[model samples]
Target: MSALDFIPELGHRVRESVPRLGAATRFLVLGLGRPFHRHFSIQQWLRQVYGFGVLSLALMVVAAFFTGMVLGFQGYYALVRFGATSALGTLVALSLLRELGPVLTALLFAGRAGSALTAEIATMKATEQLSAMEMMAVDPLAWVVAPRLWAAVFTVPILCVIFDLVGIFGGYLIAVPVLGVDSGTFWSQMQSNVSFRGDILNGLFKALCFGLVVAWIAAWQGYSAQPTAEGVGNATTRSVVAASLAVLGLDFILTALLFS
Candidate 1:
């Protein structure tokens, strides 16, 4: 295409994107605010918590354990070269708590929970269940969106904490018993370097932001989906992809802000 033709096309695309972004933003604001409305039900949020947190518990714990074990093995080998294997505890703990724990958990949450959310909502839309709710004088956004969003926003940080704890245990098991490092030194180094506020709180904050991003993106994609089988599948895929990228991108920004 000619340069002039490309310029107008780009401008048209940008203009189209404005409304879509505005809709998503409005959706987020409304969904968040809906819980404060008088008719809000705590049970709905609880059910979503079970769906987003309890159902994903095993997956999160298992992944965290293996990730920590892998970090332990690699950290030992790398640190052994410099005769600094004693510091393995600090390395593994900081890496997991500050970076791996929250980031990996977020990615997994995006792939698993986020995709499920999108598919469920999109399916409801495709089957006209959302429209049916409207016909019944229900606000679908309040019933369908708020609870899921808040549950996700709340649960992921808890999952992140679980991931950190399980991962640290896994690393300790490998570092102290399997790798033949002194148990005392491992605990000492980690305890000395890792502070609760700097490491744990910061990581939890990151997880919170990531959860919001994941749930919001998933819900928006599903709500905006084309209400067909193919569209639902596409929305699910897009939710995961978009949420994952947003988590990574946000992680970098958070890291720079919190640590640097």
Candidate 2:
């Protein structure tokens, strides 16, 4: 294609995307508000909680375990060189609670839960299920999208907490029993160095932001996808990629604002 031809196509794509972005924002605002005013079903919310939170528990635990082991191993060696091996517990706990715990949990959520959500919604659209709901006077956005969004909002922080806990245990396993670090010192030093507000709560805050971003991108992409199998697949892919990028970018911004 000629350069001039590409210009028109690029402009067209930008114009198309702008309105969709606005619509998605509106959808999120309305979804967030509606539950407060209307009678949202507790059953639906619980179902989403199970789907988004419970279903992903095993994977989160596994990831946290391996991550903690690696941190323990590396931190032990690093601190040993400086004769500060006693600080290993503090290093592992703080590192997991403050940074890796939230970031990696979010990336995993995006890859696993976020992609599934996009695919599910897009497939529904592809099959005309969304249209059917609309024709029957049911607000699909409120019924389908809102619950998932709220679920994700709640679930991610819970998952992050779990990740931090499990990761710390894994670190302790490696540091204490395997590496011969003093068990009492491990727990004690962690308690002394890691502040609840500065590390743990801030990590949860990051998880909350990541949850919203991941859910929003997944739902919006699915809702706006073209009604076709290929479109649904593409939307799922985009949702994962976009949510991952959003998590990393937001992590940097939040760290600067909250810590710096």
Candidate 3:
């Protein structure tokens, strides 16, 4: 546990990760590029959309609702201290539409669907299915990887929008009747403050970026997984951890760029 003891381990990790990151970058380039060379399959993309988006809808709704309700309680109390309870809707709406909605949706999606994507691909690799596709003159990158990548890139923003709407409603339910704030004041303040070009669009853009990060990381982790059951589990875990960290890091950079 000595401070000096950590340096060699950290350096070892950095050395190992440099090559892996390079390999992943190559995989990403092929994943993004190969689809353009092949005939597109809308059906394949739709199937993946269902898996990544529709299947995860209930989780999104429940998480978003509770998150909004929590925000309502916190925002109301924090604002009321300054006699600014009337800004509750503004607080909740701006928070959701700008930051919470996209970021939380991405984290949840990375945990749920990104892990699933990595697990599925890793299992297929473990079972030699990707190799079998190659033997049949089919490119696995095009047939397997592209659809899921595009589907995730498309669905996450839609999910974020849904999260925002549901979260706002949950906050309203708490702020209005439950907390006795006027409904009109709540919504009107939100409407007056929230803007299409600023709040909503920025969130959707963040969602889009997160989708790409989740899909790319998950796909690369699975594609590069060791062909073993234990490797599949490890790859899935890595996908979630990597995607979540990437989303958070990107959020800070993007927020600064968009707002500053």
For this target, which candidate reaches the highest lDDT against the unseen true structure? 1
Q: How do all models score by TM-score? A: 0.97, 0.93, 0.94
Q: At residue 83, what lDDT does model 2 achieve?
A: 87
Off by over 4 Å in 2: 1-16, 37-39
Residue-wise lDDT of candidate 1 within 88-113, one digit each (tens)? 99999999999999998899998988
Ranking by lDDT: 1, 3, 2
Deviation of model 3 at 22, angstroms: 2.1
- Clashing residue pairs in candidate 1 (N, C-alpha, C atoms within 3 angstroms): none
For 161-197, candidate 2 gives per-residue lDDT tens digits of 9999999999999999999999988999999999999
Backbone clash tally (model 1):
0
Candidate 3 residue-wise lDDT, 154-175, digit = tens: 9999999999999999999999
User: C-alpha displacement of 144 in model 2, angstroms?
Assistant: 0.2
Better of 1 and 2 by TM-score: 1
Give the range where candidate 3 is weakest over 10 consecutive residues by summed lDDT: 33-42
Candidate 1 residue 240 Cα shift, in angstroms, is 0.5
Pairs that collide in candidate 3 are: none
Whole-model lDDT values for every prediction: 0.94, 0.92, 0.92
Summing lDDT over every window of 10 consecutive residues in candidate 1, give the lowest-scoring window. Answer: 36-45
